[model samples]
Target: MLSYSRVILSLFAAVLLAASCSDPTGAIIPDDHSLGWGLALADAVRDSEFPAGVLFMVSCIDVNDEGDPETAIPWQFYYAEVSDSTNVLIVMVQYIGTTNHIWEDSTSIPLGALPDYADAGPWVTAARDSLGSAYSDWEEYALVVKGNEYPEFPVVLNVAVLQFMSPDTTEQLSVILDSDNDNVLGIIQY
Candidate 1:
């Protein structure tokens, strides 16, 4: 038989464990384009203890094929902390249904390779508008901001839109924009 104090302690521990494992899913709004969603994502990243440094990429995954542009979906933000001249600690924040998951990996990357942090909402909207009728068919979108090798520009925003035709077929559209001014640099389909 356990003492009353021991039983109470056990109950408290069990409750804490359950609470930690439970999903906190009620906070995120269902609209990704809203400023609230962006702030919430930023808060999640800060709460997750990941480096809030420059963002390397931001991706919205599994977006609905319907024409609802405001619908929220899973999003991923990637950041890097350069530990040395040739190695970097990559931190990824994945936000899904108001829950944030943090993942870390170490890889080799050039020093001072940090990408500029930009508000991707405007750029995403611009790319969607450029798609015209095809925007409704896109299932995913991603924004990559990084320094480019091209001497003409220091950094560029590469937006990729993906559409799924079937289980085995997928098409991609790449919209390259000038990061400084959000001007369309090029568009390619693949």
Candidate 2:
């Protein structure tokens, strides 16, 4: 009983509904490489209108990609006001459905000392390559960028590749790198 135009409109509406139901937020494809890291950091700093001088540490955790060391992941930038070191500001950037979502919060406990603000792409690549075939066994990756708190090393890049053996047991490989020259300081397995 419906006209041709009405039938066509109804079918179109049905198709749209199906698509919306399938992917409500569209695809969540991450960026090509760790390029998102710099982009997100810049976006967060610009949008938040916060002074970059206070930034102390940058980190990303819970990364799951096994093959690509440069895979994009959410990054967190930590800043501490010079006068008020007791409270630290956290700027978190997450990519969702082709756009980035940036949010900020404050914490009482900071991660570490100041950051060297070095590019993490090269460090990640070197770390993964050093792992060789063992890289496949790690299900998660995490990296922290901060000044060396120890007197022994001037490390600024701390990358951890981990594989969970059981609920309480895990195997971890730690890659330490210097920010001054991007040199691999050490690789320890535990």
Candidate 3:
């Protein structure tokens, strides 16, 4: 049977997968909303990650902005064509919309101290789903950190990270990396 934490992660992931997309040009981290019209794209890339012609789209969703220390959530999306010739995966980080994360947290919880669960859900889905596939194939995977707890709160901002892949011999990537809250990095392919 699945543990409560696992179930929460699963449900959160599923819910996020369904409604995960932001403007990618909103507020900055909580308490730092003054950062201005865009969020920084945190990314890492390597050669042979995927084939050429791979397209990537990214978006971020705001979780809360009710009051002070507004927390902006990250919801990224990637779309691309899958092909045998594709052999390079480039991780491009893009800014998305702004969100208010305060709606989910209480007065005692610090915005920055918020658990990884808040930032992890959308990030994992975005990073893993960058290929526009609902899931990943054997050749690659996007390492994502699964959460154990699904906090009960409201979302103020919702972002979508869209990506495009180059299609060749492989089928169209149509899924994101689904995990079981193991905290293991999800793999990705080109």
Q: Please, what is the whole-model Cα lDDT of each candidate in the order they appear? A: 0.49, 0.54, 0.29
Backbone clash total for model 2 is 0
The digit string of per-residue lDDT tens for model 1 on 58-175 reads: 4454433331223444455445554432222233333333545454555332323333333555566666667788766654554444444344444543333333232334767676
Q: After superposition, how far is residue 186 of candidate 2 from its true place, in Å?
A: 1.5
Superposed on all Cα atoms, the candidates' RMSDs to the truth, in angstroms, are 7.1, 5.9, 23.1
Which stretches of candidate 3 lie above 4 Å from their native place? Answer: 1-43, 46-48, 51-53, 63-72, 75-79, 82-190
Which scores better on TM-score, 1 or 2?
2
Best by the lDDT measure: 2
Query: Predictions ranked by TM-score, top down?
Result: 2, 1, 3
Question: TM-score of model 1 relative to the true fold?
Answer: 0.50
TM-score of each: 0.50, 0.57, 0.19
Report the error of model 2 at residue 138, Å. Answer: 3.8
Clashes of each: 0, 0, 72
The 10-residue segment with the lowest total lDDT in model 3: 102-111
Q: What local lDDT score does residue 173 receive in model 2, on the 0 to 100 scale?
A: 67
The reply for model 1, stretches above 4 Å from the true place, is: 1-36, 47-54, 62-72, 83-97, 107-119, 129-140, 145-168
